[model samples]
Target: MSGEFDFTGQTAIVTGASKGLGRAYALWLATRGCAVVVSNRPAGDGSSSAQAVVEEIVAKGGRAVAHDGPVQTAEAAAAMVEIAATHFGAPDIFISNAGIQAFRPFSTVTLEEMRELLDINLWGCIVGLKAVWPAMVDKGYGRIVLTGSSAGLWGQKQSADYAASKGAMVGLARSVAIDVPKGTDIRVNVIAPAAYTPLSMGSIDPKWADYASPDHVAPVVGWLSSPLCQSSGGIYHAGAGNVRRAQILEGPVHRLAEGDIDTVMHALDRQPEWTSSFASGAEIMPEMVKASGS
Candidate 1:
């Protein structure tokens, strides 16, 4: 099945393509016949880690270029996209995979660190999305895959800033899925990836050593960024050679008469099952209103 998916004329911009999963994605895209633009912060005399990936791709008879610059800024992101367009034509796929992590307790997290994480993780994706949106809209086709984290979806200790940034990405993807120009063919989605990369090796416990590698994450990412992906406005969890969709479910809620503080309190104290009823968002609101009698 994988062999059938070819990207002969497509171009992709993969951020954070210096190493890890981003590098893996760039190489994979190239092998699949897509001309790739690799972007990362300037390093090694203003050359980026993406440069190495570009070299590897070229060695394998694939087309690739590296863009070493800050991707957090709208201007820089625009320039990256422009580079792809001017060189290979308008990008058909975008993977906003650049991210950073600062582990600290919520109270101990500094404003500086918080801002840095948000800038790199959240704002970076926003900039990349905006940069490619118009061209994709005009062409009536596009694919975007935003990198999210499991920490963003579930609570984690000492990951306040990281979780917050990732959580914002989920919402960003969801909103964009709904906001794309009506009838436009653009598809936007998020991936909560659990893979062994430089970022995870030291952080994740060794006992779970069988999880997927960064290379494993690329196939799903590549698929999501392909014109072949028909689904949009969705979240997928991919790792350990497994891929599945994830949905935000709501629990059953209870309603109480207005001004009935006692009933509300009683319900709160006795409604264990209601608290456990994990349903959808649409189910929660009406239940809450009924419980509040408002």
Candidate 2:
């Protein structure tokens, strides 16, 4: 089937484009007529994951350039954006997907490991976003897709560091969506992809493997990166050839004008209207204010 979305004359940057979901997203964007910037760390041979995607795009009559560098650094990310502009003009779409995952118990996670996880998974995206924000705002058009994971939404045992970093992505996207300069046509969205990328599914059941291919989640990323997507500051779940809206819902809260320790304990013990999640700050803040009479 033909894709409903087209990105003709647009430029896109896909980090971690050497393999898996990032690769899928880069190739899919190229097929849809986007001039892509495929970025990754500089491999020993001077080739990177970015180069692989660029080659595929070129072979398929699409325009693309490889940006081999460390996206985790501000200088490297800025350089990558500059290269993209030189090759195909300003990037209209940016996908921050560079990350690494390690399995270890919470007690075993070292401070260094935690810092590295947050640096690459969270700060890397922040660097890229800041690098591109200016031109995107100047042009008054931009689409940003941040990589989140199911682990970010639902806690995973033995994945404390990775989960924490991914959770931070949701907060970053939400802040950007609400705080971008007025009149800028920029939209930021998060995708909690449950794909069997290199970073995930090493120990998952083989029979269920088909449900988590990177290709299955590409369409959702494509749609979110398209000009037709009117929604912004939203989170979505994509996998198993299915794309659906994922939301945070607040449970009914109890109001207490003044509560002693016992009263607080009683309210907690009642366990009324329990829900799995809560809505965004936008939705819950008003209720919070009303509840507090603030």
Q: Candidate 2: minimum summed lDDT over ten consecutive residues — where?
A: 274-283
Worst 10 residues of 1 by lDDT: 273-282
Q: What is the C-alpha lDDT profile of model 2 across 1-294, one tens digit per residue? A: 246777888999999898889999998899989999999998877657567678888999999999888878999999878998999999899999999999889898899988888899988999999999998998999999999866777666788888888888788999999987888778899998766676765744454555557888888899889887777888887766766676666545656755876786576543232121222211222333244343
lDDT tens readout by residue for model 1, 116-169: 888998889898899998889988899999988767776567888887888787
Alpha-carbon lDDT, every model: 0.79, 0.81
What is the Cα root-mean-square deviation between model 2 and the actual structure?
8.4
Best by lDDT: 2
Candidate 1 Cα misplacement greater than 4 A, ranges? 205-211, 258-294
Runs in model 2 lying further than 4 Å from the true structure: 1-3, 44-46, 206-209, 265-294
Per-model tally of clashing residue pairs: 5, 4
